[model samples]
Target: MDAEIEVRDVARRYQKGGVQALEGVSLRLAPGTFTAVIGPSGCGKSTLLKLIAGLEAPDAGEVRLAGQPPEAFRAGGGLGIAFQDAALLPWRSVEANVAFPLQVLGRSRRAHAARIRELIALVGLEGREGALPGQLSGGMRQRVAIARALVSDPQVLLLDEPFAALDQILRRTMTIELQRIWAERRITTLLVTHGIEEAVFLADQVVIMQGGPGRIAAIVPVPFARPRGPELFADPAFHALCESLMAQLAPIADSR
Candidate 1:
């Protein structure tokens, strides 16, 4: 089933620090579509993602997934999240790590054995299923993390700069891999990224944000066709849109 996300006039404040991370933030992610949120540092990009993931509650307003509260849907294994850190168990093999969620949910590992293996292959980690995370490269580990996130067949996937740690070459490669993986399922996805090109390449809409009580600055639609390739990076139209987004974000960054 497809999943839709809605955040209505959401607001969040950190009482200890007396900081308002987000204010009057609202968005709707259509079912099976991809959306990327980009902004300068401390613009509450990650905060918005957490609110949508149900990892944190808003100080005011509401967040819903498929008409149910995020917490409610999340409890049913309908949500999956991957962060910059792979966070895989150093001791567990790739397949073992992927299967961990099912174990945590008290689902039968035996029943999910094939599914786990399939996800390993999907992330291009087929032969490495028995390899421990410690033995894998940074990008490989992140691929395992992606597989783990998909093991549950989640209806919604949230990515928090999953490629931020990789070098430029690896980051671009992973971006392509991610685009392919996302195409296979078309799960409703929200990605928080710092790279303007990455956001444009992967998202159907690019949401620019402003800091100091973060709020949406602009939402730009990406009309490019699907399965976007590396060549898109060199396309004049692509560069123009990215440059336009940069222009919009420049003032916001300066203000911060």
Candidate 2:
């Protein structure tokens, strides 16, 4: 598969003293590849995602999604995003929130009704359509967010700490669920997360970023085969790879 997302020699800066958020950062993602980016808090992991999502522009270099600008791609419904915040409207029911994006794209309610239902079901919220965000548990809210992100049937998915707020057990289950969802769709995905274990468990490749002025430190290909589950946690190879990535991030974390 060819690269679906590409960031070439990109740079960004803001504030006095020319504080750079990222410098000469470059990356590429293949079709259907799940990539997790891990780095210190100031490493601009989220900024990289925003740049790809067309929420921000890079100061230098080019960012392309399958040969088009990020905005153009997203405008065509080729991108989806889920963030840590969930950001659901408190008054909107789960179904309405999931259908918001499709509606914004000029899709009629009739045209998108089936897609919205499918997405809600896909995220395991089949029975919660009438419930408001306040009525749902944190995990359920996150599922609704995920469903909203996927409702557009985007070609790419960008997740920034989407499961950070869940309890450990719920997080693990959600991770398993996300893996299954990804398996079924095979959409190219880029995830920015702080969890080393989660990065290793869900990613085909893990990207390590240097903190001071974010740049690629290393790109580690995960050794495990796909259809991964909680069972992989006990495998020696899984622990070994997780430890290796942890060691690589140690200095970066300490410096922050």
Candidate 3:
């Protein structure tokens, strides 16, 4: 099967060789799959995501979305991103904030208005449509960010710690909600996160990264079925994947 997302032998350097953010890194995501990338900070997790998003140019190697350049794919409105920061415009109401992407893309506001409403409802923020970003809690803002990302129905979704601002309990709740939302769309997704359980629970494949000038240390396919729920936590394989991922990240903590 052809990969929906591919990163081949990618190397990126910053500050004229001050730091080799990534070197010889490779990755692939099958069409309609969810993949999570985890590693110590500065391991180039975000860099790789940026390269795939066409936000940065790799010093070497290439990133392809469906065998075409990221820019070309994105030009067709095939790319979407939700960052850890909600990055909502404080003055805009939730509805307008969710509709911001459409406005930026010069899409017809009337044509996509129903989709904007559907996304707002999809993210469970229907009643808060008129609320301002400052009026909502951190999690709600992230929800708005998510709705903004998906309102355009991009074929590939890129997420970077979209739930990082929430507390543990809320983060878990949002994680489950995100899974349900993702199930509805089934877009190819790559998420960069620090939460092992989050990564294991949400990913079709959990990629563990280690070493400087980051490279894929291991990739473990999730063993559970889709539309996963809390019952999945009871599965032995779920706990095992969590434990295994923690083990891989353990060394990074110890060496620090």
Candidate 4:
């Protein structure tokens, strides 16, 4: 079952001298849709993702997954998250790392063996399952992380800068690969990214944020058809939209 995410008038503040991170930030992601949040540093992008992931509580307002609170839905194994760092255990093989979520939930590994294998192949790490994280390259390690995240068959997937560390070429490749993987199973996905082009490419809607107590600036719907190919990157309309989004961000940049 796919899940929807809702953030309603959310606010957060750090206790150390009341550093406000987010204020009146709200977003709703319909079931099986992809939404990407983009903004400058200190814009509370990761803070919002963490809130949806149940890692922190808002000082005010609420976040819900499938109409239930984040913690309640997460307890049922409905959420999956991947971060910028692959964060794989150096000692664990690709296959073992991908299976780690099941281990954490106390599910029998044998019962999920086929699911593990499918996710490995899905992420294009098929024959390298036995390879340890130390043996894989940066992109490959991130692939392992992605496979691990999806192994739980989550209804909602959250990603924070999942491809930010790669070189330009590798990052583009991984972005395309991510789109392909996402097409296969349209989980409700929320990605927080700094790359404007990346946000425009992978998201159904591109959400722009402003800092100094972060809040939504705009939500631009992506009109391109999918499976979005490499050629879309070259399309004039694509560049036009990118330029328009850049224009919106310019003032925000100037204000910072």
Candidate 5:
């Protein structure tokens, strides 16, 4: 199968200088795979997402989507992104927010209404379609944002700490919801987050990054079976994986 996304020795630096956000990073994501990137703050996790989304170009190396340049894929709606914040329009009702992307793509209302309804239901916000972003809780808003991201039917989904703002209970709930959605949609997903457990819970593979000119330190495959539940968190195997990832992150933590 073709790689859904590929990064080859990618590197990036800001205009201010002396700060290399990423250095010689590379990865290949198989089609329909789910991967998570976890690292310390400022470790270029978000930068990687932006490069893949074509929101930022790398100073060196290449980012490709299905053998095409990042630019082409981005312009063709091959990628979808969700940020730390929901970034929803407060004025738009839930259904309108989910329909925003379809409208941008010039899909007729009649053509996309059914899709919009399906997405809202997929995100578990079926009856709340008429409400505004401000009327929903943080978790609900993030769900709306997720629905909008999927409305375009993207080949790849890029998420940057999307569940960071939710409280513990809600965050866990969102993780399970995300897993269910991914299983239903089968889209390749790349998530950048600082949470170890979140990474382990949602990813088929976890890529750990080292701080200060970020680079991949380790690639850990999640050995657990799918359909994971809260009970998995209590398993010794789960804690062991967390400990191993924590060990890799320790140096970055100490340097800060």
Candidate 6:
């Protein structure tokens, strides 16, 4: 089967030869798959996401999405991205914020109005559409950010530690919420996060990266059946998976 997204021998260096952000990394994301990348603070997880999103270029090797280059795919409305911060315009109302991408692509308001409403409901923010970003809670703002990401009907969603700012309970809630959204949309997704348990819970595959000149250290398949809920956290299988990931990441921490 063809991968929805493929990274072949990718490398990225930053600071004009000061630091290596990523070195010799490669991975493939299956269609409709949810993959999470986890590593230490400077492990290039976010850099990888930027490469796939075409926000940054690889210093070497290639990143392809459904057989096209990242820039081409991104320009063709094939990619969506949500960052750690909601990054919403404080001045824009919820509906307007969600509609921002569509407008940028020259889509008429009438053309995408129904789709915007559907996305609003998808993220469970129906009546909040008229509110400004500052009026919403952190989780709600992130939900709006998610709605905006999907507004363009992207084939793949790239997330960079999207729920990391929330309180633990809210973070867990958003995790389940994100899974539900992914299942409903069936969009291939790659998430960059530092939380090991979060990676195991949300990913079909968990990729652990080594620190500094970051590189893939391990790729572990998460065999847990989904639509995973809080109960999955209590399962022995889940804990075992977390333990295994922790073991792989331990060496990276020790080396620093």
Per-residue CA lDDT of model 2 for 31-83, tens digit only, reads: 88999999988899999999999999999998999899999999988899999
Model 3 residue runs over 4 Å out of place are: 1-3, 252-256
RMSD for each of the candidates: 0.7, 1.5, 1.8, 0.8, 1.4, 1.5
Residue 60, candidate 5: Cα error in Å is: 0.8
Highest-scoring model, lDDT: 1
The lowest-lDDT stretch of 10 consecutive residues in candidate 6 is 1-10
Clash totals, every prediction: 0, 0, 0, 0, 0, 0
**Candidate 6 lDDT tens digits, 1-81:** 223899999999887768899999999999889999998888888989999998999989999999999999988777889
Overall lDDT per candidate, in order of appearance:
0.93, 0.90, 0.88, 0.93, 0.89, 0.90
Worst 10 residues of 5 by lDDT: 101-110
TM-score, per-candidate, Cα-based: 0.99, 0.96, 0.95, 0.98, 0.96, 0.97
Tell me the TM-score of model 1: 0.99
Q: For model 3, what is the C-alpha lDDT against the true structure?
A: 0.88
Q: How big is the positional error of residue 75 in model 5, measured in Å on the Cα after superposition?
A: 1.7
Residue 54 Cα positional deviation in candidate 2, in Å, after optimal superposition: 0.7
How big is the positional error of residue 256 in model 5, measured in Å on the Cα after superposition? 4.5
Off by over 4 Å in 1: none
- TM-score, structure 6 vs. true: 0.97
Please report how far candidate 4 places residue 227 from its true position, in Å. Answer: 1.0
Stretches of candidate 2 off by over 4 Å are 1-3
TM-score of 3: 0.95
lDDT of 5 at 250: 93
